[model samples]
Target: MSAQRPPLPPFTEETARQKVQLAEDAWNTRDPQRVALAYTEDSEWRNRDVFLRGRDEIVAFLTDKWRRELGYRLRKELWAWTGDRIAVRFEYEYHDTAGRWFRAYGNENWEFDANGLMRKRYASINDLAITADERRVAR
Candidate 1:
């Protein structure tokens, strides 16, 4: 956590934005353990067709994902929210071991604790495109 952590259960849009920003920052760092800490101990996640529960499963899933999706980059946009539940639209691009590029579009539904630790998550994703230029980034 940052030394200047703001009060969670953010009351303003700016504060919520900051919280999401922090989570994304950790996620992009590609350290699964660190990212898992942002969620509650018993958080449940559904990524694509896979279902994962608890922090341990979350960490394992992320590790497996990053291993296969090399040089991944992601951008997340807030879509909707009410109280502790939030929806995000995201895009991610990555290259596989066989040197294939892919851009994936996804939507995530998340519920957070009062302190902003994610408690539940569901993600729907599908590959969008693959192009020569995107592969160059993996280099």
Candidate 2:
């Protein structure tokens, strides 16, 4: 069995908040392998229009993402949770190769296994261009 990432579900408001924060912190690391550990080996994901299956695919996708979206920083808030599922609302700031900044707003739904490894994730996101001076995410 995999080690549990705790604050395991059937969440209270506080625990759900913690879970969201944990996810935010991990994503901020911009380390694909490290962040992939938060999910199950065969975890499935729908990120925007792309579909991914397994940690290997997750790692590859995130590596490509962070490379394209430079200086990424993110914040996530718990929208709701029940049983082994959680919903989150998040915003992230990043710049493209041309140094044009954008803020991405997204919602994610996650379902976790008994050991607290997320088994499924679905995300819908939209990006708004912003001036670098308008950035809200602190480095």
TM-score: which candidate is best? 2
lDDT, candidate 1, 1-139, per-residue tens: 4222343664356666666678667878899999988888888889999998899999999999999988888777777766767778878788789978898888998787776788899999989658756543323
**Model 1 / residue 14 / CA error / Å:** 1.5
Q: Which regions in candidate 1 have their CA more than 4 angstroms from the true location?
A: 1-7, 134-139
Residue 102, candidate 1: how far off, in angstroms? 0.4
lDDT of 2 by residue, 87-108 (tens): 9999999999999999999999
Tell me how many clashing residue pairs each candidate has: 0, 0
Cα lDDT computed for each candidate against the true fold? 0.78, 0.94
- In Å, residue 73's CA in model 2 sits off its true spot by 0.4
For each candidate, what TM-score against the reference?
A: 0.87, 0.97
Among residues 3 or more apart in sequence or in different chains, the pairs in candidate 1 whose N, CA or C atoms overlap within 3 Å are: none
How many pairs in model 1 have backbone atoms within 3 A of each other, for residues 3 or more apart or on separate chains, i.e. clashes? 0
lDDT score at residue 101, model 2, on the 0-100 scale: 98
